[model samples]
Target: MDAPTGEQLSIRNRDAHAVVTTIGATLRAYEVDGVAYLETFGADEAAPMGSGAVLVPWPNRVAGAVWTHAGERHRLEVTEPARGNASHGLVRREPWTVTAHDADSVSLAVVVEGREGWPFSFRATITYALGDRGLTVTHGLHNLGDHPMPFGVGTHPYPRPGHADPDDCVLRLAATTHLPLDPESMVPTGGPVPITGHDFAAGTPLRDVDLDDAFGGCVPGPDGLVRHSLRGPRGGVELWADPVFGWVQVFTPHAFPGRAGRAVAIEPMTCPPDALNSGIDLLELAPACTWTAAWGLTPLA
Candidate 1:
């Protein structure tokens, strides 16, 4: 029998590290040291880390969001009221079918129904793997229908320095450009601007700054991984990404549900807010096209 709804959580562990993945791309884990750091961010509201896990039909914020697919105009349902466009796609809250499962990993697939707003159909897979140090998440997309699919993929994880105070942590972001926002609705107003105090190129102490924005043009490691980190007094956590994640959104929610200010979200995305309306970096995948992106976390000694 299929594992019970919530009981289907995959448990992966290696030495002192462990990871948990719900059948629906919800990755939550209680580290050995008692830190409940979420490797994948969508499960519960109060305990939710990533509000929307995978971005599809497009990424980031879209306004009234009009798109042309297969010679027809498509308009997505507005997930963001203020912006009047679909925020993330339908995969976040939908039930995903379990494809692969094991001790250290699990794969889940979600079928995105194409409607007037999103007229192209696609199948998305999310894989969670645990290594000796941290977790590696892979997103795979395959066009299930004949029509071309225009979309993007992203990952959201809330990392915490187990049992450490967040205010005392230092945050290092690998971003060189930031999107300026509209004052009234907080939507993207113009193009990318040089980062100033808003910049975290040199690693900014978390306490010294406060922000919620999209950033890009970061330096990648030899492994071709773009990393952002939050360091607590004892240990730190890293959020790794790839060139596919052209933009990273750093969110420090002091009013977070579970642990208050001890949480920070390093989000990986292919585009910035409102990609559909802006028509910037939008990917129109040929039929049966597939793409992948990886991000993980490891404790720093």
Candidate 2:
């Protein structure tokens, strides 16, 4: 039987290696010098908890799965039925066609045709490349229709603590604000507020805190990149995104498939949850126009 995630494409650069799957162009595995940096799953298994899945058109949850565009109300399929919200975006499970592949890089593309909720056509492409800087992922989207398109993009990558105990790892972020979510719906309640205890500006140990939070007001460093990291006794892993990504969602689930401990997901998004309704930092693409952004992971020495 074939792997549930379809083709497993491998790429390498020096001591770093990565596996990208055709399904969703997912990052199934990433490691350096034989040490795992991203929590990985088996080839026969689907992405668990959105692990390494790409989010496009929008990221996070869309309240009630409904939004109004040009005075017309659009209702998306409720993927998160229990919460009565549209979780993630439209293409997470869709198949992507490989456009390029080499020893240290691979590129895949997928087209999102007009559907019931999303009445616009667009093409999305993702390229994963490994180099001395580690792994860089670039995302491109082109509007294929005549109307303007509203969207956000992000990726779920769970950076692991390698051989060190996960509880001993420290998590850090470059964010200065936080978006509070409703306990039931898991949607943002209001606007962003000054980060307090959840402040990860200074590295915080992951031993006791449980986070399923979204942060905004990301401050880019002198390099013009917003960086987040997880460090342990052995080494560390850093995730950085371009300035276009102004929001981030960090999740720490107690249980993850193929894992004995909790896992950390650092998702860099262009907008906050329910941006379809709030319009906060949402991107609008004109007809025949293209939008591009990049984010990456680096294994620290």
| Clash-forming residue pairs, model 2 | none
Per-residue lDDT of 107-189 in model 2, one digit per residue for the tens? 99999996769999999999999998889999999999999999999899998766766688899999888999998999989
For each candidate in turn, the TM-score is 0.87, 0.98
lDDT of 2: 0.92
Total clashing pairs for each candidate: 3, 0
- Choose the strongest candidate by lDDT: 2
**Deviating ranges (above 4 Å) for candidate 2:** none
| CA lDDT, every model vs. true structure | 0.67, 0.92
Candidate 1 wrongly placed segments (more than 4 Å) = 1-8, 15-24, 30-33, 39-52, 68-72
RMSD of 1: 3.2
